[model samples]
Target: MEVRMLPEPHTVESYRRSVLGLVTALPAETVGLAEGLGRTTAEAVTAAFAVPRFDNAAMDGYAVRAADLEGASPESPAVLVRLEPSRAGSPQPRPLRTGEARPVMTGAPLPPGADLVVPVERTTSGRFDDGATVALWRDAKPHIRNRGEDIAEGAPIVRRGVVLGPRDLGLLAATGHTVVRVHRAPRVALVVTGDELFSDAGPRAGIPDSNSVYLRAAVTALGGDVVSVQLVRDDEDALRRVLDSAARKADLIVSTGGVGPGTHDLAGRLAAASPDGTLARVAMRPGRPQAHGRWRGTPWLALPGTPAAAFVSFEAFVRPVLARLAGALTGGEPASETVSVGWPGRAGAVRFVPLAVEADADAIAVHPLGSPDHASHSLSAMFRAPLIAMVGAETANVETGQLVPVFEPA
Candidate 1:
C-alpha cells in the first residue's frame, strides 16, 4: 500500500469548499407548521394579509377627530358631545363632528370619521357621565393606527434559505401559513474508528467512544439525523466494506478517528472505497489530522481519534457543510472571537484550548481543562463560559491579558 503525506498544513478556508460541494443536491420535504421550527425554509414566503389586519387602538383612549379639540384649553376647556364606550374589535365607532368626542378602549378600530385618539388621562374622568362630555385637561395629538403600517398585504414576510426560529414561526402564523416547505434532514451514519474506542456501557477496557455520540448530536443539532453510529477497528478491509455499505444507505457519512499519521490507516482506505476521496492536512492542533473527501457523491468527514481533535474538526469544518447541504446559510467558518491566553509556545501547530469563560472589562481568561479525570463531571459548568482564547502561528509566547480569538463551543 502507498501512503503519502501532505507537504503543508491547511487552514479553515483551505478545504471549506471541498466538502460543501460534496452533497448539495438533496430533495426537500414539506412539513406542518408545528414541525417547521428550526427547519430551513426552501422558498420565499409572502404575507397574505397585513400584520395588524386593521387599524387598531394602541391605547384605551377616546377616539375623536383631529380638529375636535381646537381652542380647548386647561382653564377654559372644550367639552365635546360624548358617546358610548367602544372596545377592541368594534366595527363602527360613532363618527364625530368638529367638536364631538367618543369613549374608545385599547385596540378598538377607529370610526370612519374618527382621526385621533386622546388618552383618558389627558381628560376628565367623568367624560361619559349624565349625557355630558368631560372637559379636556390637556390637548393631545392625533394617535391613529394606520392600515398596513406594520406590513402590507402580499409583502415578503420571510426570504428563502432562512432558518425558522421561534420568531419566524410567529411571523409565519401571522401570515396565515399553516404549513411550510423545508429542506429535509438527510440521514447520516457516524462511523467511529479505532479499536481502542468504546462508546457503549457494554465495554470496560478501551476508552469510551464519546466521539460517536458527540458527533451524532452535533449532526442532529444541524438538522441531520444520525440514524446509526457504528464503531470499527483500525482494520482497513472492515472499514472499506462498512463505508461502501454506508454510501448505499446513508445520505451522509461521518467517520471519527484514524486520520492521523500512523501505522493504523483506516480512514485512507475508506476514502479510496469512496467514488472520489481526497485528504488534506488541517492546521489546528486538536484537529490537525482531520481529512475530508467524498463517497459516491456523499461527503465523508474523517476526524482525528482524539476527543478534542474530533470535536474541533467537526465544528471547524463538517458542521458548516452539513448546514449548507440542509439549505441553511453556512458559507463561512465558525463564529470566531478574539480572546486572551498564555501558552508554552513550544508546540508548533495552532492549538485550541477548551475552557470555562466569563466576561470582564479587559479580556477572557483560560480555565484549566478542570482536572482531566473529572472533565465530564463539570462539563455544564464550563459550557456556561463563552470564550476560548486562541494563540496564532507567529505567537511564540502569550500573556494573561493578550487579546486572541475566542471560539464558541457548540
Candidate 2:
C-alpha cells in the first residue's frame, strides 16, 4: 500500500470533521436506563408529575394563623389553641379556623386557614401538666408550601442529547422514571496488529500488547455499549478475516497499529475490506494516517500502533467518531470549550496535544504534554490526560498565554 501524503498537512479540524462525517452515517440508538451513563439522550424527558408531588414544609414547626400573632412580641406574646399531633406526610386531621394553631411536624401538610409556622424555639413552649394547660406562643409568616411549588407536572425536566451523570440519574428517579430512554452506547471492535507485541510478563523482553486493552477501555469510557478486543499478527489474511467478521456485530471498528508506513502496515486494507467507500488514508502527524469507510455497513477507524501516538490520534479522531455515532455534538459546535495556551506550541499540520488545565474566575489555562521524550520516563503526566489542545498548521509559532480552542472531554 502507498502512503498518501498531502501537499499541506490536514488541519486538526479537518481530521475531526473527516471522522465525524463518517460516523454520522450511522444513526443513534436507544438503550436501557440501567446502562445509560456516558450515553447521550435521544429524546427529551419531561416530568410525569411535580417533583414533590405535593406541598411540603421546609422545616419542623407548628402551623398557625398569623392574625393571632398581631401585636405579639418579646414583651407580650400571642397565644393560640394548640391542635394535637401532626406528623410528616400525613394529611391534617382537620382544618384550623382563624386563631387556631396546629402541632405540625416537619414535612406535614399545613391545616386550612393556618397562615404561619412558628418553630418550637421561636415560640413559647407549652405542656400538659396536672389537669393541665400550656402557654404556646404562635407568631410568624405563612410557612405553607403551595402545590406544584417544587416543580410543575409538565415542566421540561431533562433535555435531549445530555450525557447522563450520577446527578442526572437522581433527577430521573425523582421524576418517577425507573427506566429511561437514552442514546445507546455504540458497540465497537478493537483489533491491534503487531508481530513484536507480547501479552505476558514471564521475564519477557516485550511488554503485553496494551494498545488493544487501552483502546478497549477508552471505547468503554467513551460510551461504547459492547466491545470486541483482540490481537492480530502482522499478516494480511488473518487481519482481514477477523476484522471483516467483527464488523458484522459492531457499529464501529477500531484497529491500532499498521497505520504507519512499514512493510506490515495493514490499516488501510482492513478498512477497505468492505465494498462501501469506508477506507481512505488522511495526511497528518502521529495519528494523521487513518482509513475509514465501512465494513459490514459499520463505520470504522484504522488507527496507528504507537501507544502514545495511537492514544493522541484516538482522542483527536476516533473518540469524536464514536461520539457522532452516539449523537454527541463536538468540534467547534456550541458544545466545545475554549482556553488559553499555557505553553509555547506549533504544529506542521493540525496537532492534538495532551493537556492539563487549571481554571480560574477569568479563564482556563492549558498545559500541553511535555515532549514525547518527557512522557516515556514519567508516565504520571501523560496517563489519563483529559484535555485535547487543538493547534492548527497556520500557527507559525504558538507563544505561551495565547487563547486557543480545546476539544472538551466526552
Candidate 3:
C-alpha cells in the first residue's frame, strides 16, 4: 500500500474564500411582495409610481388656501363655509374656493386650489365635524404630503443583491410593486452518517442526532430550501448511494460525519478521489477538518462529525456560500466585539469560542459559554451561545475587554 500525504492546513479566511468560490448565484424568479421577505433581489427594483401617489393631507385638518386664512387669529377668527369632508381612500372632493374650507382626514387627497391645512386643535370647534361655519385661530402652514415626496417615481426602491426584509417588502409594496424579482433560493440536501445516531437501543446505547435538526433549522432560517435529509449508517456504500442521490436533487450537498481521517471516514476518502475535491485542515479550533469540492456538478461541503464542530463549520463556511448562491451581497466581515471575560486560545490555531452576548446602551460585551480549550464536542454549552468569537492564532490568551471578530449564528 502506498502512503498518501495530507495537504497543508489553510487559514480560516482562505478556506472560506475557497468554499465560496464553488458556487454562483442562482437564476432569478418572480415572487409576490408577500412572499419576498428574506429573499435577495435579483435586480434593482425601481418604483412604478411615486409614494403618496397624489398630493394628500399629512394630518387630520381643514384644507384651505393659505391666502384665505391670512390675518386669522384666536380673538378675531376667520370664518369660512365648510364644504364636503374628504376622507382617505375616498374620491377627490371639489376644489376649495376662496373663503371655503374642507375637512380633510389624515392621508386624504388635498382638494385642488388648497395650499394649507389648519389643524382641528387650532380651531374653536376642535371636532372633525360640528358647525358649517369653521373658525380658524391662526394662519397654518402647508401640511400637504406632496406626491413623490417620500419616494420619486421610477427611482430605485431596492438595490440589487440586497436581502429583502419586512421593511423592504413594505417599501416595494408602497411603490406599486405587487411582485418582485428575486434570486432563486438554493436547494440543499443533508446527509448525516453515523450508525450510533439511529440505534434502536435508546440513549443508553447511542446519542440522539442533533446535527440534522440544527442544520435543517439553520438552512431554512438563512432562506435555503432543504430538499431532502437522509440518515445513513457508517457503511461506505450506503453513504455513497445517498450522496449520489442528493447531488442529483440539490444545488448544494452538506454531509455531516465521516469527514475525519479515520478508516470509517468514507466522506474524506470519497473527497480524495474526486478530481476537484480538497480535503484539508483549516487553522481553526473545533472545526479544523474540512472537505469541499464539486460532485456531479453540484457543490458538496463535508463537515466534522462532532456536533459543535459541525455547527461552527456551517456558520464559518456554509452560511456565506449559501447567501452568495442566493445572489445576496456577501457580508464583508464578522463584526468586532469586546469580550467581557478572558478565554484560552490555541497556540497555532484560531479559536472559535461560543459566547453569550450582552448589549447595553454603551457597548456590547461577550461572555464565553464553552470551555477555555474550545472543545469540539461541547454542543450543550454552545446551545446557549448566540455568538462565536474568533480569536487570532497569534494570540495565546484573550484578555478581558479584548476586541475580537464575532459572528452571529443564523
Best by lDDT, which number? 3
What are the per-residue Cα lDDT tens digits for candidate 1 across 181-262?
A: 8898777888988988776688498888788777878788877878777899888788877887877878888888787667
CA shift at 340, candidate 1, in angstroms? 4.4
Local accuracy of candidate 2 as per-residue lDDT tens digits, 1-410: 45443345455566667667666624556555666677777778887777676555556666766667777765577666666757886865677776666667667876776767776666555333222222445544456676678777878877876778888877777777776776557888888888889877677766578787778887877778555777888898898788778887888888887765567877665565544433344444446666666766777777777676677677777876777777666433422334454444444655555577787999776666566223323334446567655555566455666665566544
The candidate with the higher lDDT, 1 or 2, is 1
Candidate number that wins on TM-score, 1 or 3: 3
Regions of candidate 2 where Cα sits further than 4 Å from its true position = 1-9, 24-34, 126-140, 205-207, 273-283, 329-347, 356-368, 372-381, 384-386, 407-410
Task: List candidate 1 segments past 4 Å from native.
Answer: 1-8, 44-46, 74-84, 92-100, 126-138, 153-157, 175-177, 234-241, 261-263, 332-341, 346-348, 359-385, 399-401
lDDT score, residue 337, model 3?
Answer: 83
How far off is residue 45 in model 1, in Å?
Answer: 4.2
lDDT score of residue 285 within candidate 3: 85
lDDT, each prediction: 0.70, 0.65, 0.85
What lDDT would candidate 2 get against the real structure? 0.65
lDDT of 3 by residue, 279-388 (tens): 88898888888888777888999898888899889988899889999998875578988888997665788887888877899977678886857457677777768877
